[model samples]
Target: MSEKTGTFLVTHADEGSAVFRDVSDGQVHTMASNPDVAEQDVLEATIRPQPPMEVAWEVVEVAERREIELVDTDLSPTTQAMEIAAEQEVGDVERVERAGEGEVHVLSVPPETTEDAAADVLDDEGTIERAARLGAVRVEVRREEDDGVLNVRYLPD
Candidate 1:
């Protein structure tokens, strides 16, 4: 069988098996065995259908693997992000694509919970999954010190 090569994100992994999602496309691949990969990991790999059934895939070669870095910055949200936050209600989120690559996410939360919300975003696996989908290498989280606004910037290398 022919092999497919692309960037993939490890969407789920456990002791027995793992699931990968193509970054460029939304195709899903399931592997029968754990490939020493963890959830939220980004990988450049070649995969081929398993023999017989061909319902599952196997990683033939892995060219690269990486983890998205999450950073907590003391910097406040950008002017554009602040403006978007102002127009949103508490508990709302807005996503804006960057001019080049990646994305900027504006979140509005309670002023008293801004820090907690920021921390939650930084710790969420979905944040890394989003970065992988956007081909981003890092995520920078910025929060307003006294306001109810936060900016999560997914940056490309």
Candidate 2:
């Protein structure tokens, strides 16, 4: 079946990282915004839409969404890795950090958490695949065959 797909405008502001507002809901949140924006959801559900001249409302494509925060979402792969590595002495760690002011999750964490000496463990499962598992956080999947280019942005909380 074809994946449900729609377009989203990457919003950027000096106040914080970019945010992906629902093209239909007029919902706005930080790039690190959670799927459940208690505050914004309330507004979108209760408050009516108004004319903004340039735009009227926004909504995100539900099917294509793989949970990726852009700009500066909080991400913590390192801290998690530290925790996991503590259990295993040998493992590879690549990316870990806060995903802005949103929730916490272990993105691209190595099999080992704390005491790993390698970075490749970050993608034992691969780049985008690992990122896809992270749902709702921004991840750049690059050619796994080469080293460099892959990136994950999690805003600091």
Worst lDDT 10-window in candidate 2? 39-48
lDDT for 11 in candidate 1 is 88
* Candidate 1 wrongly placed segments (more than 4 Å): 1-6, 11-17, 23-28, 34-36
- lDDT on C-alpha atoms for all candidate structures: 0.91, 0.32
Q: Which candidate has the highest TM-score of all?
A: 1
TM-score of each: 0.80, 0.23
Q: Which is the leading candidate under lDDT? A: 1
TM-score of 2: 0.23
Give the poorly placed runs of model 2, Cα more than 4 Å off: 1-62, 65-80, 92-125, 140-157
lDDT of 1 by residue, 1-157 (tens): 6799998989899998899998777789998787999988899899998999998888999998999999999999999999898899988999999999999999999999999998999988678878987889999999995778999999997
Worst 10 residues of 1 by lDDT: 124-133
lDDT per residue as tens, model 2, 1-157: 1122223333442332344443443344343323333221111112112234422232333334333323321233344433543444222334444444422332223224322212343333233233333333443222111221223333321
